[model samples]
Target chain A: MSLSVKHLLGIKELNLQDIEQIFQTADNFKKVLQRPIKKVPTLRDTTVANIFFENSTRTRLSFELAEKRLGADVVNFAASNSSVSKGETLIDTVNNILAMKVDMVVMRHSASGAPWFLAQHIDASIINAGDGINEHPTQALLDAFSMRERIGELKGKRITIIGDIMHSRVALSNIYCLAKLGAEVTVSGPPTLIPKHIASLGVKVEYNVKKALEWCDVANVLRIQLERQHKPLFSTLREYALYYGVNKSMLDSIKKKIVIMHPGPINRGVEINSDVADSKQSIILDQVENGVAIRMAVIYLLSGKREME
Target chain B: MKTLLNSGQLNITLQRLSHQLVENHLTFNDTVIIGIQPRGILLSDRIVKMVKKISGNQQLEYGKLDITFYRDDVASRDIQVPNDTNIPFSIEGKNVVLIDDVLHTGRTIRAAMDALLDFGRPKKVELLVLVDRRFSRELPVQPDYSGHTVDTILTQKVVVFWNEKDGKDEVILIDKL
Candidate 1:
């Protein structure tokens, strides 16, 4: 079966079936990656443009690699070096790219809901990479995939998202995704770093790191977005590390081992200790590997929508 | 609709095909059996079983190949979900028998062969089919061991049903109109 939506704008627009379809597709792509000849000719006739208004390493490269692996012609656009700096409008920039015969767009922007706005004005399908404090759908998907690989089914599994809940697009998307999969989610961090009224999203809030770590099966520690903060939210990185950081000793104190995860560019000793991030329980690297597969699945499913039209 | 081969005839043809395979690849020491995905798997599964039984070599190499990624008409048709490609053993320097239920356009075999080469270079490759739609082939490809052969028009279709999937073992030719 195909995905319900044409564009993967956000997890909020996805039903449970869409998520399952993507996971199943990714399973096939994962096997393809393990072969001697890892490339496939599925998208040989298609072209995709990757437009990043924000900076990224893992997500952008992962999307580019997925596109190349599927044999799609890719053109990369970086905002820092583009005409956006010359006061060109978003619509104008995208129209020029579309004129070049691009079939799809994978975009990350500094403004929230940028991809949604672009989707309304463009004929090409849009995949939201990350928007300002809004949602990172692919990151959430890869996180869930990694967790499902480690543990069996996500239903009734406890997932604790620790650190920078107020500023993380990943946290919002993960909450939406995990909720649809019937998983229990707990948002844990310092009081200032966590958003008020977060319980409206149907998640438990925990201010103490140790108690939160002890209560979940998976701890998806998010990076502290120092760049996103315009005002002082937390006192200091050292204080945050001392109070909210996930260290090996905190995990060792728990009765059973819990799966550890991070969407990278990790603030090594700040949100997660070096030892904890590299420990046996950590699946940070697996999340990166699955990112390529997940992006491939998303791109392939979206490209199939073209034939239906 | 017309019945080409009933359950009794299907059984005899499968047995004969298996014997023919054993005669060529004695003990299957260097030969690997691979089933093309979707429908070809049904014929290949039975043929593989019989070949193993006749040769008395339970460890014979076998795999299932899905050519969806290598297909040339991906964007022009419906989205085809890929089946599992489980070629655990390398096909390098080995003989590979590509088995299918029907050989019609020869386009699928072309795609299947391209998919097979990605694993490793095989010494020799051959086609095995349950039914050969003789004159309908768009390409110059033929099966090495065929159970049955029929001349058909382009508008007609050849369908094989297995008890495991279709609740019977039979071959049927259907007129489109």
Candidate 2:
């Protein structure tokens, strides 16, 4: 078998075998983490470009760390600091970067499918870090990996993704990966925010938080859309939190050994209660640690020398 | 006639197998061996042990995976304990060899691959089984490395027991009467 993956654009593009290959590769890199020297010369000659069109600290840092750990020369590009502010088109900017002969581009863009577009146009391998409200495949993969580490298996597990489902790329990606792994996933938010057609993708849509929480083994609390407040998406933050936030009282209602997860830049005291955010059940930190390993796995699997046998 | 492999034969086979694995340059710069539970994992442990004794690299990471949840038969019958699928190491950018005790219908390896993805990605994945019984395969799959290949009928069963289970390591050919 020959292993080759040039680009990691989305979760939907991966088959079961491709996903396993990434996981297995990531498993090998775990050794470098334990050693006193946590750097490898595997990708010593490769250059990785981190192009973030949106504001992100955690994701950007993790990608940077992963690239550096794997011995790839990393170049960070932020919209505010780059030529984009000078009215350069994305294609022009990408072309300018491509002229430098970078090996791979990890992009976080505000427009949905921007990475997909770049993947089609560019010669370099593209990895979608986050793309608008469409998908954050790597985050979803790390979350799946984290959950698998804790729960052992994904089949038949009830996973409740609670909060602003409509504007969440995390929710979309998680739903896709979880469903693919045989999990029974539920997406719950205010009726206005939960897309009606989302159920077609093998996910249950819930308007009531309590009902969804009652049956979940994993409660993935998503950050509410503070930016959507004045757009008539919902009435008020206080009301939404009162109805949907995973507070201590709501957390007490579930008897299963539940794990709490949040993709960070968390709006503490809002989407998740303060206590629960710091509780023993919280794997938010684990999600961050796993993010590096997951991205490392993705990069290594896609860029490593393929074995044809 | 009953075909049997004693404990000593099994050990010798394993040493030869490990030597062959090294000779093929299968131990790439970044590679991981993941054992399919429960017997496959034990086999992986022994392979890792032998690899360490030969090279002393200490970089070889091993993982144990339970493919029950990912099995196609899960929907058909009741499942017992879905044991821990632990790969404390990451698989990204590494060559992966999935170790197993015996290769039969290939369905188990297929299921193991499905279960393996929940962890992370690997550069490549190769199947390594102790015994490759050349029976009718339900799936288009074969082991990359095998201790031995035995041609068997559909009615025959290949049983491999370790000392941990049966006080010795041996292979048994049993007819389903």
Candidate 3:
């Protein structure tokens, strides 16, 4: 039922049926995850390489665990300790690993389109963990997975993605995924942080945070890219908090019980306040739990031996 | 095409199987009924209903398992949409009856057994099938209890319809044209 793609480069490449198929596969793996023994021998005959050029904790560990749980032999390689430190090209690094018989690769690189570039030249199936500000396909998959778990079918549901959109791979991937699934997606943040010509991608850009929150059934507050900022995007952190930070008082003002979501490493008091992030309506933890299942589905689907009916 | 068993014959076969289960396991304290997911669940549900009616007790443990991830031919065949697995209790030291609608290449049963071992080690595991498509098993596996055995060719397929969803219980064999 999956689309015939060797690499999961971005959500831009997936259609509605591919997304549905991955969700359906994730649903099967979710049942396996809940069992007393969460390991399956589906990929025992295969091996994987997790190559992370960017610093990450959650995505890396989730992919590693997902690969192991599927019974695949996994080898992790971070840029700092790998041949990349010696100035090796991306293709060279990946090809070296593939020479050892690695069947698949899960890569997280700082440059946008890095996974796509490697996928074209490499023999192994490439999964984009996060490719700079371009896309994080698995994150988007888990986000949609969590949303479907809480809100059921996404068709016609209003989803408001908040915070820094221009620098968020999560937002980009989510916009592609949610829009394709028939959801009315809107992006809101500082005017400068919002990308140019985003409306062409089929989403409304609302500058007012309150109006965006009011219009949405689910509000996904992404972490502001403090590290990626070279010049100040806003006047100050306090100024950003005043206009964008979602606090208890701000949330309490709204009568509707809206689901709150954040792609972690949450910057408390920056994009959203502590109370709101830890609130009963928050599904950050559920997103993390579903992350493993999403990665499992991605890996299982992209395995070299894709059997088509 | 030929009908191996119609509604009346199907019900009698399931009832007889349930009685045989009761005669062997007695109170069923150490027994658990597990159905292969998707189609086998309908047959398993019918069996559970018959057993509960005959014993006047609804305490027997029953569950459904999907073997999609455990299948040996996953990489070589079309990927199947997996159903749900709902086992609330452990199979440790228990007698397990693994049920399915048909016994084809015996691969499905083999995959089910592999999945079952992950939950816990059972004292023994048995197989029950509505249609035993003989002479085509690819593995060294056999059913302990069977409703009926059909002699089939390589080019033919066996389709089982149940009253629970198909409006009536029936088994029909078809040849590939």
TM-score of each: 0.98, 0.66, 0.94
For candidate 3 chain B, the 10 contiguous residues with the lowest summed lDDT are: B73-82
TM-score sort, best first: 1, 3, 2
- In the range A28-100, model 1's lDDT, one tens digit per residue, is 9999998878999889999999999999999999999999999999999999998999999999999999999
Candidate 3, B136-168: lDDT as tens digits: 999999999999999998899999997769888
List per-prediction Cα lDDT, in the order shown.
0.94, 0.80, 0.89
The superposed Cα distance between candidate 1 and the true structure at residue B71, in angstroms, equals: 1.2
lDDT of 3 by residue, A21-122 (tens): 889889889888988899999989888999999999999999999999999999999999877878899888888999999888899999998988887797
Best by DockQ: 1
Sorting all predicted structures by DockQ, with the top scorer first, yields 1, 3, 2
The iRMS of the candidates, in order, is: 1.4, 15.4, 2.5
Off by over 4 Å in 1: none
DockQ-superior candidate, 1 or 3: 1
Give the per-residue Cα lDDT of candidate 1 at A228: 94
Better of 2 and 3 by TM-score: 3
- Displacement of the residue A196 alpha carbon in candidate 1, Å: 2.1
